[model samples]
Target: MYVPPAFKDDEVESIRATICSAGVANLVTATADGPIATPLPLFLDETEGEHGVLYGHLAKANPQWRSAPTGEALAIFMGPEAYVTPSWYATKQETGKVVPTWNYITVHAYGPVEFFQEPERLLEVVTRLTNIHEKSRAKPWAVSDAPAGFIASLLRGIIGVRIPVTRFEGKRKMSQNRPEADRIGVAAGLAACEKPQDREMASLIPIPA
Candidate 1:
């Protein structure tokens, strides 16, 4: 993705945090037929490689997985985002030259892809993924929550994915290009928004009022 220096996010820890917080992402692959993408919930093993490895699953019937990817696959993780109106800029009052923009955080990871059907590994992946999302629930579900036969049958209908992220790019465009006064105005406007995501993005702006 094209990113200006002012908006570039090069901090490895911060980038990893953004990916983790995103929870779900779009995994894209190019095939002889065309490009295919699937939205997936993934787990990252940061210790695995330079940028770390991503693990997830897709439906066994999803044709996207059957087609061999010609090149590296891409995973996009998007975080908090908020709208910035011209009115939310000091320049709009001073010179009326400000334009509307958006403040958001995102990460793009690219790597070679591998798909597997190992039942034991699939079982482990499913269990950890389930625990990650269900830990917050009062009554969390588990892979063993179902009958042995039923769980085994269900696992047969899915495939596991492992991609070692060779490249990681992160972008955090939170009004860093704006003047201090404009940044403050935008943050305040977003904080006042009724949307929880907008409010969350407002809090992420590094430039404080």
Candidate 2:
């Protein structure tokens, strides 16, 4: 959350891309007892409000839904990330002043939280969520694939969540603060690594003009 000016990501499309690509988020809420969080697969509804709405579900047994929230809820979405060794910085060879750092993208959405149990709404939320994730499959599955009674029974064990996001905090730390040579070294180093994520991160590093 302590995003420096160089790392701040305020671009609307960039923020939305990070959220959508994250696929899952950590939903957190402050309560009288304490803070509670749940890792949830959430989707953004850009049509809903000024900042858009977030939708997800939680198991009925999860106490996070039962506790009364004291303030706005926070949903954290994380994107590509990789460790950057000082060895990848040209400054390490030139002046030996560079230290290790991390490159990553993240978004934090905050808004009022609402929990609902209506079977119809629950069904709709789950169906839409399922379709979003399954659409890429060779044979995409649908809620209609299952028997009505079976689907209804399963829906009873979960509760729906909705958050009309009031604000968003996005950060993209991709070696933007480093010198051009150091950044190039980082990109090359990461691109050559075996981890696919590191290679993915390599492409996100900004190339100096």
Candidate 3:
């Protein structure tokens, strides 16, 4: 991910938090034909492995899963991000050396990928994933809410994916390389932005404890 030392975020909990907040991830695989990617919602089981295990599903007709991956798979999780303009840097006024950059959080997880379509396992995966995303709703839904026959028929149209994470590399480039004054300016500028995502990034900027 080309993370500089100043921008590296190695905290395990922090990385997990980012992954969960992402809700969906980009799953990439290298195949004999070429690289293929799928964007889908995934849930992490932190207790399953030394690192953790990721679970998700894709349409059964998606060719990306039909072909065997030739190498390790990568799941990319992205968090809040915002554009940082030179105008937000105090250094711009002092030395006119600052340039535009992106401030964001990302986590890359690598592991062997496995694709399966067993109906029982597929049902379990679907139920758990639904719970994770629906738990916060005022009127939460459940896999059992649908007729069993209907749900079974629907499961046949998708395939489940599992990845036992081997390692994780996370980066949080939140204006950490800038001076304290410059960082404060960036935070203030982001907080005042019209985009809600910019305000979310503002809350992540490190302020003096």
lDDT of each: 0.90, 0.95, 0.94
Q: Identify the runs in model 1 with alpha carbons over 4 angstroms from their true place.
A: none
Model 1, span 20-88: residue lDDT tens: 888789999999999999999987898898888999999999998899999999999999988889898
| Candidate 2: tens digits of C-alpha lDDT, residues 1-209 | 89999999999999999998987899999999999999999999999989999999999999999999999999999999999999998899889997898899999999999999999999999998999899999999999999999999999999999999999999999999899999999999999999999999999999865
Error of 1 at 29 (Å): 0.4
Q: Which runs in model 2 stand beyond 4 Å of their true positions? A: none
- Candidate 2 colliding pairs: none
User: lDDT by residue for model 3 over 1-209, one digit each (tens)?
Assistant: 79899999999999999999997899999999999999999889998999989999999999998888998999999999899998988898999987899999999999999999999999999999999999999999999999999999999999999999999999999988899999899999999999999999998898785
Which window of ten consecutive residues has the lowest lDDT sum in model 2?
200-209
CA lDDT of 123 in candidate 1? 90
Q: In model 1, which range of ten residues has the least summed lDDT?
A: 200-209
**Which candidate do you rate higher for lDDT, 1 or 2?**
2
TM-score of each: 0.96, 0.98, 0.98
RMSD of 3: 0.8
Error of 2 at 187 (Å): 0.2
